[model samples]
Target: MQERNVDIAIIGAGSAGLGAWHAARQHTQSLVLIESGAFGTTCARVGCMPSKLLIAAADVAQQARDAEGFGVKVSGVTVNGPAVMERVKRERDRFVGSVISSMSRIEDEDRILGAAHFEDANTLVVGDHTRIHAKRIVIATGSRPTWPDFLNGAGDRLIINDDIFDWDDLPESVVVFGPGVIGLELGQALHHLGVRVRMFGVGGGIGPLGDPDLRKLADQEFNADFPLDPDANVLRVELEGEQVAVTFHCRDSDTEKTERFDYLLAATGRRPNVDRLELKRTGLALDERSIPRFDRLTMQCRFDDGSLAPIFIAGDANQDLPLLHEASDEGRIAGDNAGRYPDIRAGRRRTPLAVVFSDPQIASAGVSYAELKRRDESLASIAVGEVSFEDQGRASVMRQNRGKLRLYAEHGSGILLGAEMFGPRAEHLGHLLAWAIDQRLTVERLLEMPFYHPVVEEGLRTALRDLNVNLRRGPAITERCLECGPGA
Candidate 1:
């Protein structure tokens, strides 16, 4: 193989790899990026953008159907599945094209369109032609949807996120096997779009939410839209005549349940795409899950010597935080540190933020209620405050009054530790909470801030007020200013 030398080499052309390339370029120009598949990341191609497009179409149909509650009688509401899918694909391709174009800005010589495997700690062999020797390497190879062993019998009947958006026509009914973020979102969207959708999961939780209360609310709401049987252990899957039959044991009720659908969509989760890399040749030992032990603060891989290597892993490949924003942040950290190498600097960790884009969106930031309850040191000091949107003015006006909002704080310090909510516009509320928690803002300080009238944010204020009461920590700024500061 022809050998090439570079200051840095990045694997994967997805968000994380692109991020690393962008940041690493600041430090060195002698670098290369290797990708095996489409240049666009998962989010643009399948995860976020395309799914949101589908969800938006479903939302329009759902809104039209639900318009009667607002004294607006609407008739003849129907969704064209093929048309919706067409639009989603059209827009999705645009997004993917944009990502590819951005990467195309790099010189053609630096971009290798092939799979790469590690030949040694500092060498990577691409396909059969080129071998790259780099001072530092960043592995942002990303992840792929996993198909369980039980699904082997289904063969061509199995569906996955990678190919879901490419369907010419929507299935009449589908069995979503996994109630994770993707499963829940797509299941609900398909249901709204007139597809009979049922979802089952091996975990008790719905979506990615950790807060039990929020999960319960989401469970209720999502179940109303589609059949969601979580904590279900799928036993076997096979073809029954024309449909796919699934046999699963429901953990909650301790019973076996069988269901049939036109097709089976597996949203079970994803596995890091590292197996083909031949990482063992690089002297890096992988854990049971094939993940390299790395420092979260430094993003450096732990070598066989138990010392840090010049290699870094980020994004979904690391499987630490699978969200796009977190992946991008991790990529930057990995790139910065890998470019700096021996002079690596520690990166700041942001407060955790997770959101599931289902109806009455589910969101959480920082220490969730379940997390605090699990920690002995924090449980006693934990306090929860909530506001129901069932009767909230804005929710009622919008005819979307169906969920709740909650804020968690430390009782003694009254600091906003985390928040979990399932309500209309919870995405925005979740972002607000994430920013405040990142700033270490106290509940009292948050209350002192302005809350606009007749807005969804008022619901947030109400929760904070309740939180303040639970903590018994009043506002830092008094309601009265005592005659306008000096001498007004």
Candidate 2:
């Protein structure tokens, strides 16, 4: 058997793993990275890049159809599904290739092209013959889409995000299960591209907006494109001829409605890839969720004696924060801490930012109003400022005013705590709010910043102005950084 030794070993060559590698390589050369699949990360190959490509294509088609609203009647619009898919794959392949090319710059010996299983806290066995003794191990194996037991008989009818982008043509009709991020994004995109799509979610809202008000607004805009059943509780599957039959039952209704579709997309959610690594061999305790316990701040696992073990978990595999940016940050923390083991240090986490890239784009930063209200009983001390695109000048000019923006802050402190919105270019607005919250900026401070005229950002200013009205400590807004004397 072949044996080797490394100071730090990273499992899974996805975004989190790559981030860990990049960070740890700076401190030590005694590092090895292991992968059993394609070199490119999930975001590049399946999750983010390819999905955005398809969404961009669908956006074009949607714009063409909506051109009549602007008093410009354009006709002869035809969507070639195969051609669109071709371009998506061609472009997606280029992205995947770039990721692989960068990784290839590492020496071949440092990259082990196989799955790794833990033999002990400091030992890993790769395949049958190659054994690696790592002083510290960083688990960044990421996650995979999960299928429910109902899909057991779904032979050729099931599709997940991993394979959706590879299709050469669009399905005639599809029933999307779980109206989370993947389901809503793909469902809306497919509907825009002339596919008949029906989306089902367990709750009354789509995506992870976390606020009831924002979810209602998002559902309204999303339903305009396709049939959305956000309250579907039970889904039963059966076969109907060559097609798959699905019965959706809403929580309030006793009736069962069955529909047959050419495709069934299971976007329920994703689970950490922890089981495959044989974590039991590591001698770490597993929680009820079958996940190894690790410190959220330092990303370090503890031994039975409460001492830090030479192990770390990061990215989706940790099941804490699954977003790409969060994974990258966690990976860096894990790698940095792993290399400097026995002297573990916690790094500051980034401000919470999540986005759903559907039309109007649902995004949020920091804590949501719902979360604050759930934990805090003093609702009067919390203030919410809202601005609707229905009346915004820029939105009206472009005929794209079908959403709302909400900003949440403390009533007395005027500290921007969180923001939730469904508005045009909300992704950009969300980032601004995230940075402001991260900096602990006050409402008065944000108002002092410049806001241009006739832009979506003006809507943010409007919301901030409304929020400032409820601040108890000071005036709603002051124009200057410091309360200035009259030209003295």
Candidate 3:
């Protein structure tokens, strides 16, 4: 067995671990990154990268299908699911290969291909052969798709997000369980590939914390193409020969129904990949959800001894926001704090900016209206304005007019609290709102800022104008005035 010492040892080579490794690399040459599998876990291999490729293909297919409506004569159009899957796999492999080749540039000793478990506060045993002693250790093990016991028997018949990308042939029909971000994104992609996708979940929208209006818009758009059972709760999964059958109960009807599909995908959710690590050996305790207990601010794992241990956690393992961007940000913070002073201070991080990659993409940041109302009774906010795609000339030109933009600002302080956008080019519109919310920009500043006219972003200008007008009218304006007043 070989023993080595390093400044930082990062477990898992996914987004968060990679972020921590890159951040720590700039400060110290002695950094070790360990992974059970190859680099680029779900995000690169299956979650975001491959899924987006499939979505892009679906977009082309949809455009071709809709071209006839715009007086563009189109010949017979056919969707080749296998070909689409092949292209998706090719692109995914290319990206993953690029990442792996990049990792090769680092010293061989710095990268370990094995599972790692903490031996002590600052020591880790890798693959039962190599021992790594570090001043600080970071756990960026990420997460795995969660499937309930009820679906256990389905076994090989059911696929997870990680398994879907490996398939060479696409299923003619897919029943996706759970309405989380993955479910919606993959569901829409599969549907666009001509798969009859029936998404099961009673949850309102894709992401649990996405803006409600955005959720409604997604439901409206996707429901037109695929069956979105919002209140459907899957109770069991059974393998019937070549097909998988799902039995679910509807919340509204309280009746059970069974649906058969060529493939069953469990997008139920993800749990931190901590089970195999045997964390109990190191005296680290897991919460009820099986996630490690850590200080949310510092990303430091809490210990019984008044002193903090060097074992830190980031990304999905911390069970914070599971978005790749948020995880990487947390990893950078954790890696920096781990190597530096013990009590390094930093401001609290607010709710992260999140987006759902769907046809009509959804984006949201800051406190939600429902959450704010729960916390503060007297809390008041002015909805600056909501401009539909129908109102945007760019959307009209592109014939992608199927979304809206909305901004919310504090009633008194005028600081931007949150924003939501749905429809074509919603993701691009979200970036501006994300910057505004992150900077806590005032409505006055936002209104004064120059935005290109005749663009989708100009919708923000329309929204800000509405907010300015409402500010001029006192606080006593009724909901009717807010909706359809002379100025409105």
Candidate 4:
């Protein structure tokens, strides 16, 4: 067996792991990265980058179909599903290759192309042969698509999110299970591509975790035309000859119904990839949720003796937040604190921002109103604004005017609490709110800042206008003379 020593070891070369490696390399040269698969896991190859590309193409196809409204009488606008899939694969391959090439450029960086398991507190065994010792270790192993046990035997007819990109031809009809981001995005994309799509889930569309208004808008856009059985749960998948049948149990009624489809795509949630790591040897404690019990701030895993190890956890494995950007930032923070001189503890105040990539994207930042209500009964929050994209000039011009922006503010303090946007350019607008929340900006100050007119950003101005209306009627109103105000 071969042995090596490094200042830090990062497992999983995905977004979070890569970000950690970049941050650690700035401090020391003794950085080692290990991945069971090739560099660039689902995000680079299948998850974020590839999936968004297909969504963009599907958007174009939809827009082309709506060209009649623009006084263009265009016909025979056909969607070549095979061609679109080919382009998606080509683009994904290019991006993945570039990431792999860039990772290879780091000096003295050991890249182990095998699975790694903890041998002890500071030791790792990889590929049944090599042993790696490091001062600090990070577990950033990402997640994989999962299916319920009852639907396991569908065999070749069953497709997960990862397998959809590998399809040579699109199926005539698809029944997608799960109502999360993946299911909604893929269902809409396939529907726009002319595939007869039906979605089934237990909760309402997009689940109960997202914004209600945003979920409503998404349902109007995609679920309105497609059959979305929100109160439906899959019971079994039966394969007969060349056909596959799915049996679903309705939550409203006790009736069981069966439907046949050309393909079944399961977008069920993902679990942490800790099964192969054999974590028992290290004796690191875990929480009731089966996740490693670590300090939320410093991300240091504690031992049975109440001593802390240099090992850290981030991304889906840590279970702080499942968003990609949040995981990347957390990984960077963990690496920075792990490599700190004298090992000073770092305080964690993370404001997670996430965007669900759909036709009308859903993006949110900071705490949700429901979560705040649960935590603090007396927490005062004002829904500063919930305006539609139809009022925005840029959205109308782009012909993507089907969304709303809702901002939350602390009633008394006037501090920006959180923002949820579902419309054109929701991702960009959501980041703007995330910046404001992180900086603790006030509604009045945010409005005072200059924003260009006739742009999509004017939607933010409109939302702030709602806050101004509330502040006018609010008890804390402080009116100043227009002549002597800052405007003078």
Candidate 5:
């Protein structure tokens, strides 16, 4: 094996690793980016980008069907699955090409195509080819979908989200497991595209919703489209001919039912790709999942002595926040700190923001609703403001009004702590709220912002005003705010 020395070594050539490579290069020119798989980032390949492509097509089909609500008659709305897959694959390749193109800017010597494992604290070995003694290492190996062994019996009848984009055409029906972000998005998209989709989960949680009210509202709306039992008691899965058969106790029903489908999609969850890295050789302090315990601000893993180790883990490999943007931010932080070494300074950590692309999109920013419930302080310390989009003017006009929003604030400080929403345009709303939280703005300050008439944002203003009233900093909410639509 050829041996080499480098200032920094970044494992995985995905989004986070790429970010780390860029940031680390600013301090040292000697670095290597190693990968065991394709170069494109997850978002560009099997994740957000391709998923959105499918969602966009589904949305168009849904819009056509919903046109009758606006006195527009739409007779036939057929989804051409082959053509849909073609565009998805074509656009997906374009995205992957762009990422590979950016990677081409790096010197060929800095790139290695093989799996890397730690030989010791300061050494890494890649298969039987290269040995690297890296002064500092960044583990951005990312993550992979995880499911129970029982599901493996499905053989070719089982699939993950990654396999969906490669399908030559849509299947007639699919039985999906896990109602998390991945399951919810793909299941709904397939449902709207006229595919038979039945989703079941062990937990009652719907998407990213921690607020029970929003989850319940989401449950009702999603169930109207297809069978979605967020919490179901599943017995077993077995292979029946070419199809997958599932046995489960239906939600709210004591009777057991067996269902067969073309495929059993496991959108269950993801596990960090750290098990095979031989981290024990580094003698680092690992968490329950074998991930190194690291400081969020410093992004530095700790040794057994609780001192900063040379190893840093970021992105999905850390498994803290799995969003693409968060991974990029963490990668930069880890890379910069690794490069700086002994002169390490804390990096800027952005306010938390997560958005689920399901219908009436789900989003959460800053503190989560579940976090507040764990607080021992008085309930009076936290003030909540809520708005229902069911009657919101713009939402009704768009025929897309079917969700709710909640804002949490400090009672005495009047500062907005966080927010959770299951409403129209939540992607945009989540961003505005995240900015407010980052700026440490108060509810009163938010209410002062302009809300144009007949916009979905008027709903945000209504919630902020409600928050102001709860905080007792402003006059009580009027029965009808003439300036904005009446809760409508």
Candidate 6:
């Protein structure tokens, strides 16, 4: 076997591993980046970029169909399924190509192409030919889509979110399992593209929402145009001829119904890719998931007695927050710390932010209301401000008035804590709130920021005005200021 020694060894050259490579190089030159798969990020290859391209087509179709309200008579909105998939694939490859080109710049000597496993805490074996001994190791192997074993009954009829991007054309019908981000986005896109879609989930989760109200609202909003049972009482799933059949007891009617679909897209969830690494050989404290117990602040795994183990896990491997930004930040931190061993320090973790590109788009920033419950803090200690887009001026103007935004603040201190929203422009709204949370802005202070009129952001001011009232930190908004425009 070829034996190599390095200062640091990073597994998985996805976003996290790439970030680690760049950051770690600052403190050490004797490091290697390892990958066993394609040289593009999941976001570029299958996660975000390709999905957004599909959604863009879906959005165009939806807009063309829904243009009647503006006195624009639109007819014959033909959806060329194969053409849609063609653009999706073409643009997706463009994005993946860019990422791969950048990755190609890394010296071949610094890049090892193989599946590696732990030979010891300080040693890794790559396939059959190479053994690597490193002073520090960073696990950034990312994750893969996972589902329950029962889903296997669909056999060849089953697919995952990853398969959607590779399709030559949209299918006739699909039954989506797991109404999280993937399910919602893909399901709605397929529906808008004139494909029959029925989404089911084990739990009553609409997306990545922590607030129950937003979840319910999202469920209602999405179900308006398609079938979605967040908590499905599915009785059976099996292959019937070329299709998959799903038998379920409908929650609304309590009647057993059987539906056949071309495919069952499992949007279930993802598992960290540490199982094949043989983590048992690491000699570190491992959680039930077999992941080494690592400090989030420093990304350092601990030995059984709580000493640093010279190993770190980041990105989807750590599974703290699966967002790409989080993975990148964690990888940078872990890499920097691994490059400068025993000089570990806490990394900067930004205010929590998550977004789902489902219709009306879903977003949450900072501490969620659900998190407050987990903290065992009294609900009364926090104040909530609510704004319904159903009557917001700009939302009404755009004919997108079908969501709600809820902002939270410390009751006594008036500090803006977090926000959850299921509404138009939530992607933008989420960023503003995350920035406010990161700045530790109070409700009063946020209100001092300028808000341009006749924009969707005016709705933010409306919510903040209500929040100021709840915190009682400032005078109530004048009754005249209650409405920004017609029916606002």
Candidate 4 backbone clash number: 0
What's the lDDT for candidate 2?
A: 0.85
User: Candidate 1: minimum summed lDDT over ten consecutive residues — where?
Assistant: 479-488
- Greater TM-score among 3 and 6 belongs to 6
Task: Give the alpha carbon lDDT tens digit for every residue of 218-300 in model 3.
Answer: 66777787888776677778888888888888646879988888887888888888887767766765678766788778788
| Per-candidate RMSD, Å | 4.1, 3.9, 3.9, 4.2, 1.4, 1.3
lDDT of 5 by residue, 410-466 (tens): 987889999999989999999999999999999877776877778989888888878
Score candidate 5 by TM-score against the native: 0.98
lDDT of 1: 0.85
Instruction: Report the C-alpha lDDT of model 6 over 1-488, residue by residue, as the tens digit.
Output: 99999999999999999999988999988999989888899999999999999999999999999899888999779999999999999999999999889987688988888999999999999988889999999999999999998889899999998899999988999999999998899999999999999999977878878788888888788889899999999999999999999999987997999999999999999999999998888888999988789999888999888878999889999889999999999999999999988888899898999998888999999998889877756677888898889988888989999999999998778999999999999999999999999999998888778887688888888888788888755565534354556433
Q: What is the C-alpha lDDT profile of model 1 across 1-488, one tens digit per residue?
A: 78899999999988889889998988899999999887798999987999999999999999999888877899869888789999999999999999888876899999998899998889999998999999999999999999678876676788898788998778898988888889888888988999988787876878767777777888788777777878767788899887888888764577888878888888888999998899888888578988888988888998888977889999999999888988898899999888877888888888999888888788888887767878854566877889999877677778878899889898778889998888888789999999999999999889879866577787787787777777855543324223322110
Which of the two candidates, 1 or 5, achieves a greater TM-score against the reference? 5
User: Global CA lDDT of candidate 3, please?
Assistant: 0.76
Candidate 2 per-residue C-alpha lDDT over 1-488 given as tens digits, one digit per residue, 9 for 90 to 100 = 78999999999899889989998887899999999787899999998999999999999999998899888898857889999999999999999999999997679999998878998989999888789999999999999999778875556788898788889998898888888889988888988899888888776767878777888888777777677878865567776767778877743577778788888889999999988898888788788877889898988887666777889999999899899999999999999988877778997899899999898788889987767888786777788888887877677777878788888888777899999989888889999999999999998899888876667787788788778876676755634212322110
TM-score of 1: 0.94
Error of 4 at 275 (Å): 2.1
- Give a tens-digit lDDT track for model 4, residues 1-488: 99999888988888778877887777888878888986765677888888888898888888889898888877867888889999999999998898888876765337887899988878888897789998888898987778887666576788888888888777798888887889878888888889988888766757434566676666666655687776576777888666678888754588998878888888878888876787777788877766678877776787767778788887777777777777787788777766773364675656767787776787888877567667666554554566778756778877777778888787767788888777888789888898889999988788778776567887787777776666534543234334422211
Q: What's the TM-score of every candidate structure?
A: 0.94, 0.94, 0.89, 0.89, 0.98, 0.98
